[model samples]
Target: MSSKNSFYSIAHQVNKPENISKVLPYYSGLEIDIAYSASKKQWVVAHHDFNNTKHYSLEDWLTSFKQLYSKRKSKLSILWLDIKTLDDNNIKDMLSTINKHIPKNISIIYDLGRPLNIINKNFSYKNIINNLREIDGIGCWITKEDLNLVSKVKNQLITDKVKNTIISYGEVVDIDLEVLYKLCEINKNLQSPFSKVFVWNIQYIEEIDELIAWQEISGMIIGYKKQMWNDRCLDQLKYLNDLKVKFNRNTPTTF
Candidate 1:
């Protein structure tokens, strides 16, 4: 794996403390989604569509994360905070809670949902960006199916304020290298070009190799669904580890 690119495990689907223990050690990044609970007036770690009865409060989840990070003393390179519901109060609360519990070592990426939602509402996008400007990174979901909407959001972020934004293309149903290359080209041309490109719901391991070849892109984060982990997933992990070793060996020694 290139130093600029990394792997992330989509632990939101499993959304359990034990699953974090199982997956955190294997990857450089962990992707988790949080939904706001109006009644509780708190953010809980759960997918948006799921019933709210079982999820862990954002505070509790972060506490568990802190304990795990301490015990392993492992480098948790990226923390992808996928905000399922965004509002002024919850956003403030979430940021405050994160700052208090999560260690400073981890880089936090705010993965906001689709771009059009922001564009449609008055001042909504700006408000979100203003809040996110303080984070290490910001990402928005994009797909080829909606180029116009994607272009609008891309143009808005090109301004000077927002930095280290990522364009996340959901799921890998098929590998269209040319299309992906073009997307990367557009990203590079942005005044504030995206610092990374991420993809989830990956089904084939070879897609990883293909995407890695595109060094023109700033960085890449490959993700897998939580429930899909099996022997093939193990194979991919092993392959990535081998690549890391090879990369380390090839670097010239500096004395």
Candidate 2:
């Protein structure tokens, strides 16, 4: 809705929690592997394996950012609540907390591996697509982690998943041209299902952006390695924006 974008939602991988402001001007949003807590009730944005940053918790990171989120308006755009290693028991509590912490429409991306149960979720993948039942939506992530998952969807009863899930793909993964084409085709046909094409977290920012842009990915999930920021990511996004404008008239929105 805002024509605005979030650039490098990062993890507290290697940087300090406070330096986010220093580099905030460089990109749109923060996407981290983990979340940190600045205080008992507040959260800070961080993402590192587990050992590197002891204090890194999503809650603390956000708590820190809340103080300056408005001031660093243009630099950061989105926040990533990646649960690469989470359990079923935590889903409800985590989702509830995130729903409260994250600003509306800021884009919170969860791992495909995570078992999802939205508002009316029967929590069954099968029940999700009962047609008569359609509960909520699902996550479509494409990364080194999700690429295979996306590829497998065609083989799987993915249409069923798509029917009930808000699909998004591409996040910090390596992608291929052929894969992109097939994905685009799937996405094109899936528009009726309103299945979204998520392409924003690929590490090879420019490698396949052209491929990404040619397709009408439902919504993009911008990524960042706070360590590298947009030195590479920004260049790719800029190219994507330029190409979009150039072909604004003649470009086909589907594969």
Candidate 3:
């Protein structure tokens, strides 16, 4: 890996084809919500449950990404697939479809809810991860609701032997530096699972600074809005080049 830390600044929910050209040039990647359409028998780029609501095909979205990627050939683009409706029967098809459309510059990080959801009969989390590995996809570890479940989460990661996970940064208010510190400690001891951490729901550039300065985060997924990319914010983002530093293993990585 390169000595310079690889930090991804992603645009969240840029699911439409029209937005791809606008957003790809400014960010490292795009986070797209996908749900399987039973009626259409194909994956659709949508955040809500299946309905008549306007949504583009997953193929269309990936096509748009590929076109933009061809222009920005050097950029490493990640497609964070937040699967809204994943089930056992449709997983193989979903993976196959993604493999066909995903471009060379694109990397995939998929989220399928809790890996150990006992009530979810859709599919085993580990099984989906294994399938994703076949397509060179990275699995994600979403932070849970109860703060006390840290130990349990650690055990799960150990059992799965999952390295290089994308972590979901829930509501900023719900998390503080303390929780992020503990997560870093877990990653430190575990050695590799959390080596590459991507946190979503980041609204401000200062939050980006705080996360990067602390050293645990490798990526930031900012919710997409035109005004969010104001002059000050863009300047701060550009200043991140100066902020980039090598990963510090000797010290505890903060949030």
TM-score of each: 0.77, 0.57, 0.75
| lDDT ranking, best first | 1, 3, 2
lDDT tens per residue, model 1, 39-129: 5678787866434667788899889988988888454567777777765455767777887887766767777777765455423345556
Q: Please, what are the lDDT tens digits per residue for candidate 3 over residues 1-255?
A: 222255676666777777676665656666778887776777788877665346787877787777767886345557788787766467677777777877754567777555445123237454655655422444444564533444455456555555435555554334555556666665566634444655554445345456766656666666634323223434534555445443232211111
C-alpha RMSD for every candidate:
4.6, 7.5, 5.2
RMSD to native, candidate 3: 5.2
Q: Under the 3 Å rule for N, CA and C atoms, how many clashes does model 2 have? A: 50
Q: Which candidate gets the maximum lDDT versus the true structure?
A: 1
Residue 179 deviation, candidate 3, in Å?
A: 2.1
Comparison by TM-score, 2 against 3, better one: 3
Backbone clashes in model 3, listed as residue pairs: 163-193
Question: Each candidate: what lDDT?
Answer: 0.60, 0.43, 0.58
Model 3 bad stretches (over 4 Å)? 1-4, 115-127, 133-135, 144-163, 172-175, 205-208, 224-255
lDDT tens digits, residue span 16-133, model 2 = 4565665456434444554323232323334433434455455555556666666654434445445443423334444555555555434444434422322224343333234221
